[model samples]
Target: MAPVASPTLLARLLLAVAFAAAGVAAWAEHRADLARRAEGAAFAKRYSIDVRRPSFVETAKAEATGDLAYMPLVDAAVQDAMGTVALANLEPSARKAWIESAQELTAELAAARGLSLSGLAARPGWAYHAELLAFLTYTGDRRTAPVDLTAKSARWELPARMATRLSPGDDATWGFLAGAYLETWPRLPERTTAQALPILQRAFEDPDFVRRGFGAAVAYLGVEPAARLLPKTPDALRTARDIVGKRDVPAAARLHAIWETVERETREKDLARLEELAERGDVPGRRRTAEYWLVKHPPGEFDDENGRREVGRLVEAWPEGSHGPWPRDPRAQLVQHLLAGRLASVRGTALARLGNQLTGVPDSVRARLLLAAGDRYGWERILLESGGVGSFDWTRFFTELAARELAAGDAEKAEEALSRIARPARTECDVLLVRRAVAREAGKTAEEREAEAGLALAVEDRFGAERFAGGRTVSPCVDPERWADAALLVKVASPGVSLVGYGWDGGRIGTTLVSGEATLAVPLSGLSGRRSFSIATLAGPEARASEGWVTTSTGVRGDQPEAAQAAPLPPPPAP
Candidate 1:
């Protein structure tokens, strides 16, 4: 319009402008691509991703270029890296960023294959790696979050499900699955075992499986099953012995299995087996089993009037000093004494053998044995002497002695014993019971009422409606300052009996006793819901004692009948 030009020139000018505009647009796109490449490289370096190889970032670029063949390689490498990564070493913020980046990349790769994350996860082989990535992310998040049993179950579900899909020869996957099942067994026995048993049974039958670290899982499956699965080889026996020796196996089952093995080996006259059992300070179970055998078959005589001396002959057949493992086992020695002390003829010898080394015996056992032997002097010596004794043990010993003294019409001696107990905010129920009795004998009605109020408060603290059902039960004993966290609800079949819950607290055994079917709560410190503990019921002198108590590893729920069995309490010595 500015100049009247020829038609050809006008057409050439229009073409030139169009070419310039195309050049500018191309340059801008090139710059943008370079920027994206830089970003991808930075991300790869930050997360320790190998850019030289096909990674998630590389796979994305290849996908953009319409190359789908590299998808599987990239996916596998990414998953391998993710699984081996030390996410715990990363800062929290950095960890969050890395997890987010991984999630986005996984989504992109999954989309490239015409599938969603769920579809990819369900797919077998390399495609299943995406689910593992997702699981890794979940575990990472859990590192920073509070995890309970439910959350743990959720975390395990993915791997456990993945494990089921893997081929039978995949020992690595199976081992991991078994470990997870073992960890949650106490909390979710049925759910874990149901899914795990069939697959594990198959694996256990395969000898190749034990070449890896599958022995422990087999043991956890059960001693009988493991024994059946494994062939009778020295290596198999050693593996079984090692696995059965672990504390993870139930003590009763472990002891039984070990005893069976020992019996079999003894019948075969395997000196190596005996030496292995006598090997000091390795597996405590082996030593314990040997000690048990010694106790059952003492070196001297059988309980027979015919005096067959069969066990003594067996001991003589054993290499000199090989049968002396029981001497190293103090608890077994005390048990042997307790059994020997039951008879009047050997009672003095047993008492002398017990000699001042009463460390391994519980106060209850000591009381029972000494009272049965009518060794009042020995019983009083243990009660009065407090060296190397824990507070809980001291309190228990004094409480029992005080009760016997009070029952024997010695109020002053009972008072002296009661005074020795240090009154903490919480104590064994037996302490309060004895305190109330001592106060009554001393004719102090107010003191007796105070002790009774304390006991009532303890009962209410654990089992009251205010704690359980949000309904207040006002009583003179209610004290807000002394409330403890509710842990377990314990109920006995009979009323008016004392129950004691025992657990390890800071490497020392701590006990809480509540009388008359009250709830019991051990302090939370150094205690876990799955930790094994024993509850011992102590009734008044007339109650018949049960043979032994059962230890439970599970937490008690509302009104469960899993109360402690009563242990024998021998009658007080004659005055």
Candidate 2:
């Protein structure tokens, strides 16, 4: 052979070359690591206070401000729901107590330097007013819906007295409060053409009202025989659609009530509307029947105004003997339907409000979103999707929630999170597969980690191709998606050892290999140009290894002498 180069220099050259290649790799790995860290960091940085903690006397701070007279109305509506006619002992006292409280609050509300049914409308702080009104509208006594008839006289006099100071639609919060309250006034619905007429007329005309208010006004009018006079009154669907046009209503929830009504029809096909009507034997049948009715009736296309009013009247006209789910919460019932995903509009409204608050809909609502979401998944999905994560502290969000459960602590939550993060891989064999092929390949520095996090690399089998057990496995070491080529890895360590699995694209699926290691070469076929990769791992000894996943993209690994499977041989014959 020709004179060989100096071993030291040659080694140096080879090492320099190897290091150069590795440096590129290290940089990529470094960046990727940084990226994962960043995501964790960013999520961590945007902290949120945990709301699940036990109530403390020290935190008696008010959650929201601005005009909030309607809040009690909504709470009263919910409480009123307990009055379903089916009560064993109809608490006449409870009814009287509730009505009395409502009437008192009404008196407080009747006059205003600038207050009305829409007390919170002028100030956005009272968006909940719409829902409160919506709730009360459905729950309030249809026949006796008019607050004490005598109280009507007092309310009427005050509206006129407060008329000049009464805010116009320009003051949205103000108008909504005034107009909304007035719009629902049943003081003399028979006298809809006179007396309390201006309030109703004004409530509907005011543009400041949320489209929800429009639906409310339409529904309210539908109950009065005289509502037939508003020649321009649109149907419920059209009203919702028109309000949708205002661009004021959130787009996602625009037809939520409408859509649910559509779905409710199909979902509750087998469900009956009344227990007595269903001829069912169970006692809960009454509640179920009421629930079913809520599901069955939804405002549809063109049925908007009158349709809504009809539902209200149906509740109003329910047979007096048909108690139990009784004194029906026409409005609360509808919201229940909406919440149950029966009525799209109602459900949409609930989802939107909770979603907003969870995502930082401020003041009082934000603090109680979890309470509102009530540990429901759909609510959580909406909460997560809306960039709301940034609003709360991830640490507190995850940790504090743990404190309440007697079984869990904050550290336990962290452990749980880690467990959740590691849960996908099915078997230690699978974990080892990723570990041997991916994790052990190279080391990374901080600078390189930052650089690679942002770059785009073609990663095949990135999500494991939805295959059952084989193919490229996922790298738990990284976030988002990172995969590796499982074939080219050479199992140097025992089946128990783990190694870095390299994908043709350079991305890898890594975990710990408790005992084995699979050294691998850069997969050239499936990988091309700039790419990212990770060494492998098996999670940990104590933790059961979960199943693994691969990238969504299929990699084109060139035909090469692939490593044989490192299956464990059957144990030696007894002893």
Candidate 3:
């Protein structure tokens, strides 16, 4: 029988069997897909969402870049379709229904991912419940519309309190209450405002609420009432100042009463009082003083006499020690460095004085001082001499020096500096850009000066570092490495390697695997005044590694300004 059946016939039979099995598997997969689609459609209809839209996918995937408005769509849909008159205010009948539906949806999603609703709430589900509560309380409708003042005062309070109650400590809670509180301000009924003022005032007394939702409360109370309600007595002001100094109070709302006191007493220009506040060890006080000084004496106001006075003031205020007792506030550090730079410009002995003054300062801060003074050689010297204190990066220093030279109309000097950067053709798109610029400025023949525009574009295309690198006629440097805490987008070529983030002090932050794109948002509160961060890729067998950093100032509410991003550095030059 084996001899009778040819090997070809046997091979064909096996192939036919495999195809039949594949057909059955494909049919099964298609049916399962249809079932999922049907279920998704039914859910979308129940919630009034267009599931076919790209936004729905973004919402479902819970992308950080997804529209905030889409976050509440599902809950809003359910509320609109199934919500009753009393449900709008989240009365017991409405509350129960909303919670049940929310919990059901959350549970379904969690089950799919082998998690619970609370676990999901800690991640993606946060936007749903938190935003829903914010929407219902803020607008009293599916969309952000005018609140019906006729509704009972308790109706709005129910959802506002429930937001925190549901998702405390999550970004969703803080973000939702932020919007909710702002909305409540304009629509707060006369009766509710009177009844709730004391409650809101008490809430602000807690450092937690102040950190999380004080801005909204301030908005809700209106400036005058908020000022009146905030601590006013000397002792109370000291205590309140302490809270603000801790950055527990929202930056704008922290010193409302103290500000009112300052404004009433000095029309907001009481530099003497502001300096006294700074002397009292208040961070916000230092910030306020720096801001006022910036306004009073903008960048071009630097002069010999003023520079001397400012330098003297900074030296006295910010004496150096073994990393002890230095003014840790970023704003203070900046003002001090700015004065140092001005002093360096005016006085030949400024570098000597600054070196003495900045002894024992943090490496990053010292780096800033050299950068500010435009002392490229000084920076280079520091980088070479300092064995472990973290030196100024050569590429950055050269890039800046070249730009300054170009700006000063010294094309030769600029070309020299640009030429100093190693492997300029491949290492940095900016370096190549500068090289082309210098060549053009030097009036080289078109053939001799061939602008490596194609090479720069290829590098940008390969690394996706265009945003940080391209279109720079000058230094194009994002300065002052310290940044407010915010999300950072990390893009890598492949998966598996563990990416680690670090705080300003070089402390290891949370880690994630680089499966392509990841967003890292570290809390600046614990980071204190040090907002700079570094990201490193830990190499493994399956990993592709690149190590680099970017800096930014911290944002309001600890938001990171857009500049706090790390672009992929160019790969190593071929051997």
Candidate 4:
């Protein structure tokens, strides 16, 4: 302007100005976007619902049937929430502006549809309640709220307000309110059967309860309280009968009814209904109780003579197509097992021998049942009468025997039982483990001790922690030098570490707390077989491997010794 600048210079100057303005606008917009994201994250954390993705709006819209009333309200509410999140990082004036505008739009949209966040219970129609329910689910997590919402009252007020409107014909409301009541009841200060039972009963008595899929919610909410308040009363019994009849009622509830009826009425006429439920062969749990009851109190058909005949018939008619005790047709096997237990009560040891003679009973199954009965003599007889080991499930037989021996503190016997597994699943690992266990219990040969030194070194390579310390213990099963070195390695590597070791059946053997470098021994000697070892560090991230520090190793140990060892001697003589 001062000199009527050349055209080219003027054009260049205007271009620079335009770029500078664009840069400032872009920077401001980027910051605003970042603030919104932060607010969205905060919102989700506080409410347990996400709004940033925006796909929720479409899902809600799709769920809307006749009209899209819920969708608009949902959209408005989400936008207002987004605005609130965006304003969190802005200046005070900007934040105030956003709040006023968002609240105004959201309140207007809510009011236009006769919706009131504060008065959601009074809202008309299932759609309004559904809308409120969905919204509350998204925004009800108050713990992470940036501002205090306590003055606004609790979110639970909505469901509490809607409880009075629950009716039989209103399937949606009935289901929603009943479910809400069950969830909210326990957390309330003065929950009682007086207030909750009526609502549940109303839902339960509804003709639509079963067909409309409300039976589960109603039965679960009703049965326990009904039973507790008026147990064995005619009304309670009637309710129980109704609940048990419903195919949708939970097994626990049905069992409760069966037991309540049996305990209250001693007459076979009343107990006969339960017998019918048992014979139906549909609900195994119910059938088991019924059959046991019939056995205890011989009814018209199940008298002592009939009971014995029934047992004989079941045994004689053993399904030939069945391969194992567990057959697709459980009736034959179930009846037999039940009869075996019942007969034992009367015949004692004789019944077990008879059970062994049954055609369908597997040797392992018979042995376990006899062992459970404390009939070791009978169990041994079954073993002797059993099919050849080649045809039998050797793994199951040996494992069960080992567990029984171990439980009785007979580690030597347990090892012996474990050694009998032909063509063992884990060759080297199982043999070494058994050898170590046997050597630990009894005395080890000098050669065995030396061989263990090689094992200890290999263990350090395969199973040792990243860092450890060294120490010594007098163990005849292991060389002193090797033991000391291995102990020291563990001490150094496992400082401030916690180790959990699990046995074969996934039971925790023990937890080791390491304060310094290491301790010479971990309490995981006897519990070895298909084991798992896990390490957790109290402090420091590098303590755990990238994948995880927990490792599971499946090998035969503590029960099978290597064939290379000095000629094995009858499983080291069971203790």
| Candidate closer to the true structure by lDDT (higher is better), 2 or 4 | 4
Candidate 3 lDDT score relative to the true structure: 0.43
Which candidate ranks first by lDDT, i.e. highest? 1
Candidate numbers, best TM-score first, in rank order = 3, 1, 4, 2
Best by TM-score: 3
Write one digit per residue (lDDT tens) for candidate 2, span 235-327: 333344444323322221334334335444543342324424435445365445544555444432212333444343333223232222311
- Candidate 4 yields a Cα-based lDDT of 0.41
lDDT of 4 by residue, 36-120 (tens): 3344334332332333324543453354231233344444454555444655676786556555554455333333233233223
TM-score (C-alpha) between model 3 and the true structure: 0.29
Q: Name the weakest run of 10 consecutive residues (lDDT summed) in model 4.
A: 545-554
| Predicted structure 1: clash tally | 0
Which stretches in model 2 have alpha-carbon errors above 4 Å? 1-166, 169-254, 257-575
Model 1, 1-575: lDDT tens digits are 49788999999999999999999987876675555445444444544454323356656566442122234443543464355556788778656655665656544333323322333333444423434433443434334443543455655466445644654466545554554555455556576567766655554444445444345555455656656555444344445544553432333234334444554455334433444555543445444454445554342221221112333222322222222233455444534533431233244333433433334465545654575456888766765673634355466556666777898999899988777676672244557767787889989899889877867655332232322111211111222223222233233222333323232211112222333333333332222111222333222211111112112222432232222223322222232
**Whose TM-score is higher: candidate 1's or candidate 3's?**
3
TM-score of model 1 relative to the true fold?
A: 0.28
User: How close to the true structure is residue 45 of candidate 1, measured as C-alpha lDDT?
Assistant: 52
Question: Candidate 4 versus the native: TM-score?
Answer: 0.27
| Total clashing pairs for each candidate | 0, 102, 5, 25
Off by over 4 Å in 3: 1-368, 374-380, 383-392, 424-427, 446-449, 452-575
Q: What lDDT would each prediction earn against the true structure?
A: 0.45, 0.34, 0.43, 0.41
